[model samples]
Target: MSLDAAPGIIAVTLVTVATVAIGTWGLRFSRTTSDFFVASRTVHPRLNASAIGGEYLSAASFLGIAGLVLTFGAEMLWYPIGWTAGYLVLLVLVAAPLRRSGAYTLPDFAEARLGSRAIRLLCSLLVVAIGWLYLMPQFQGAGITLHAVAGAPTWTGPLIVGAVVLVNVMSGGMRSITFVQAFQYWLKLTALLLPAAVLLIVWAGEGRPRPDVDAAWSLPLADGGGIGLYTTYSLILATFLGTMGLPHVVVRFYTNPDGRAARQTTLTVLALLGVFYLIPPVYGALGRVHTAELASADALVLELPRLMLPGPLGDVLTGLVVAGAFAAFLSTSSGLTIALAGVLSQDLVAKLPQHRLSGVAAFRLASVVAVAIPCIAAVAVPHVSIARAVGLAFAVAASTFCPLLLLGIWWRRLTDVGAAAGLMIGFVGSGGAVVWTLSGGSEPPLLDALLAQPAAWSVPLAFAAMVLGSLCTPRRVPAHTSRLLVRLHTPESVPLDRG
Candidate 1:
């Protein structure tokens, strides 16, 4: 399944140009710190939802899910389902409360609720860590997409994406990122939808012969038996709980005008994501019939168009998919960079030299650092399957921030000491699994399964540790805990004062 460089190059170029164009347009609306950071909290629900959908649908959704479904069949459907359901969890449990808290970043929420600079500092570090973990896969996926399409060198793709993201982020910060991401969502959806529609027509013309599926591939949770069940449930937990914890995702909630808008935004996001996710599995099912011999499953979406209709028509379809794929890299990376840069500037960069630096200047510097670290890692580290790398990030988030957010919003007894201890436990436990995965080693089955999917154990451990630690240090609970809980849980229509 070979492709011409001309179409891929043209598609990538167009997407890059459009991203810069939209970002530059947004620069007109971005003049102050609030504008850059939260678009002055004036974003409408539908627009905010589009931007969230754009940023949230990273390489994993754009390329990884279809590939996994193609490789693993029915069981892998859990991934996309889990990802979409995660927002459902967010809508019901977190959206309005998080917005009502009026914090720009996750650490902002932690410090505001707990009133402890120590917990804020810890939260800042984890945000940067998780942002980098998540960004690395987008970079890796970019390299894969470019190499599959234009036959570019592996390193070139990450470098290109990093540079593009830095430029977009440094141009106007979050305001620019919001516009760029919103545009990309429609771009990506159209890219996948058009190709799928065309392919379905071609398949129908050929009488739509059923693709052969073995019993193992046809049956969900039937492959690895007990281990498979554990892995599926573990994946479900990670994706569902992890959505609220992702820095790129959570930061967007702060861009809404009020708690009511925040809930509206989340509902729209669920609808948008549901629509976008439906297309990937189509590619996966079609892949079984065409391009089944391709070496990498991730390239199934990219290669299928060309293989099915190998001519000018096929080239056009492949080019559209490539554009969408590049959009995925840029949009998701830009969102992650903005969130990471916000934390870095506020927590680390601004703290230097007696805190004299201006907000925008500090943010620009942070943007570079945020994009640079992961860009370097993307090239240096050996590539894992794109979806698995992302899942590891989700595991880290699930273990650490999931408990923090759920408890901080719902329970008034959560002390700073408890939150900190839980974070460290999650970090060390999941962090060990990450190290093991990256280090490359043969291992016993039980240990291997445990390390490979750490969310099952690590998430529970973090929650338990927080509960126990809080119970032991009940006196250390913040004095403002009750007030904050009321503000978080109460509806905006209530007559009580929030701040």
Candidate 2:
């Protein structure tokens, strides 16, 4: 509430203008269909890593993590740890294989792996479902950030963000967004890093008071005995396994020039995220020392600067943080939108027999549908916590695609029927959990915890279904599985002649 409209409005305008300008520069490189979808597969490792960091560090990192740290204590540190470590999982198991698959979208990879249109359709639905799931909190977070920024109607943030995303994404797709996202990442880092350094100095000056709370808060694990441990492990499972399954995250691999670049990109992302995450804990700690309990904890990042400094200096820092917060929403939403649009355009729009739409035209149309649906949902259901929603999205991805990708890339016996069975089971289990949480369902504490963090059970069940389903349908494995595996594993430089 102490946040002022002056800094908020200025921050919004500045970030928006800079994003559009960078996107415009990227448009020239987006003329081809390949450019629109995957940046012509020419992005460099460091540059692509920055873009990945930009888009990957969503409102969850910018706002939600600080709030959680401020309110819940050290147990919430798992969010950042699992999220970053998920990349290491990606690096070892998935980064190279996914790039070598030569697929533009997750469904394309599924279809290529299984040799079944049915499997493709299932992956497509899951992509849209997961994309929309991830996007809802971003849109909602935009509303929250903007509301704190300038007392704007809660709806304005979503609408404004939706329009900006549509224009940037619909204009030049991935090619256009590469520059925008990379710029936003550094901007976001500066915004947080500088403010955090100043705030820490101020806290030191004030004797660095400890947070006044229960002993349970500083414990690394949940306090609910067995049930608490379950929730903690489930959250860990979702975030750790979920990175490889996210469509936006996966599609970035496709943009790499080859498997090697993809691996390099993941490594760089780890370092960048490590540096960026350090600052949020600073704000959370400073909040403990300087500010009282906040009505909107998610706004802690924005409020801390203004409250702690309490002058022109604080207002200036507040403006910088605001810009970074807005950048978080825009960058993440754009990446999700691009990934969703690519899936929709490829699996739905391009296949429409009634319309003779060009690939670019179809992609443009898909982009509209992608951003519009979640924008509406964000506005309609505006009360969910940004961090929790993203975590759920991670859970769904872990349950569904994590099994498929891990199995498909490594296990050759994975039949189309098996993949389809596993995807459906994962979909239903994780989707059910999502529905229960979103619907505000509650029960005895244990049941609520189980459903709330369903990844522990849902993920294992999905893997079991795939393994058993494949073992049972041994003869149903695709005939080309051997050749495809060779291609997936072979170095691009040592190509086998197709002839």
Candidate 3:
């Protein structure tokens, strides 16, 4: 079944134009750096929740997760479950306090909590790396969707998405992005849900044949698996804890009016994501019954829409699916780009003595830098699995920022020496594993285990290393730890007075 490029392209083009128009209209209200960065810290809970849901459900959620379920069965459902539940953990453990701390980025939190410029710089580098890695799949997924729906060349999708993201992010920054993402979330949910209902009903009418539970559905990790259980656990650890450390995700918490609103926003996101996720696995399950010889398991979601609903109905549904896939691409890329641009503007461009680039100049330059590297990487390394690529990003996040944020916020005993040690250990351990995996070296049994699931061990090693290192070098602990804690937890209603 081939897609009719004209109607599908027209539909996708309309959706893209509408989204950009909405975002552009938002720019009139974004007059300050604060507005651009964090929506002036006044975003209501419901809108903020939708924006969070939009940003969180990227290409991985839209395409990769459903594809994974189709390819790997019950085990793959854990990815979405782990991902959605991570926000619950964030709400219970970190959200309120993180917002109350009033830090703009993870590095901002690091410097405030640990009082180490060196640690902050290291954290910044990791943020760029993780953000770039995460961005690649979004671009790639966009390319795939365009190719599937419009019969356009593969590059068309990424190019279109990359351009749209650059315009939205550069023009209005976070404020514009929040509105765009919130709107896109609804579009995405509707795109997936509507087709799913139609397809399911059609499927029921055609006689509800059970999926091959024994053939594909019943396979285990031991049977020609991509990675083993150890690796699976590591991935779970990364996705589960990585949300807390992601610069984009963490930055969203700061957009809330207060700590309580931040917590509420997270809860709303969980419900939104829960509703969106339920439909994907249904597509995956149905794909097993309707389609044969799926070229790429990652293409399962897109292909299912085309297979189940052929002709113009299928084309329209496919077009909506394409638009949602692009939404996944645009929303995720925009959020990451904004986070990256903020870091670059503050760290790289603003530091020059004679020339200070702030506001739109800094943002535009940062957007170019933010989008270019990942775009290049996406073009260069096109073969990596989207889900696994996302997992690597999570591993990096879990390894580096996860330790720093948890320790910075919770442990007053954390010292610069300890923080530095943990960062180095995490970088070397997780970074080396990633390098080994990518370099095509003969991975040892133990090394394979380590590389595949570094988070389980690496995270603990980082924490242990930090603690032991701090204990041995207590002098490096900031003397103002208690004062910092007080400031971090204190409500905004109370004013700080320095006499």
The estimated TM-scores of all candidates read: 0.98, 0.98, 0.94
Q: What are the per-model numbers of colliding residue pairs? A: 0, 0, 0
Could you give candidate 3's per-residue lDDT for residues 134-220 as a string of tens digits?
998888887777776666777777788889999888888889889999999999999889889989998898899887666646543
Compared with the true structure, all predictions reach lDDT values of 0.90, 0.91, 0.81
Better of 2 and 3 by TM-score: 2
Question: By TM-score, how accurate is candidate 3?
Answer: 0.94
Error of 1 at 191 (Å): 0.3
TM-score of 1: 0.98
Off by over 4 Å in 3: 1-3, 215-227, 439-446, 493-499
Tens digit of per-residue lDDT, candidate 1, span 195-297: 9999999989889978777877767662567877787788888888888899999999999988889999999999999999889988888888774687578
Model 1 scores worst on lDDT over the 10 consecutive residues at 216-225
Tens digits of per-residue lDDT, candidate 2, 195-224, equal 898988887787877767678877878768
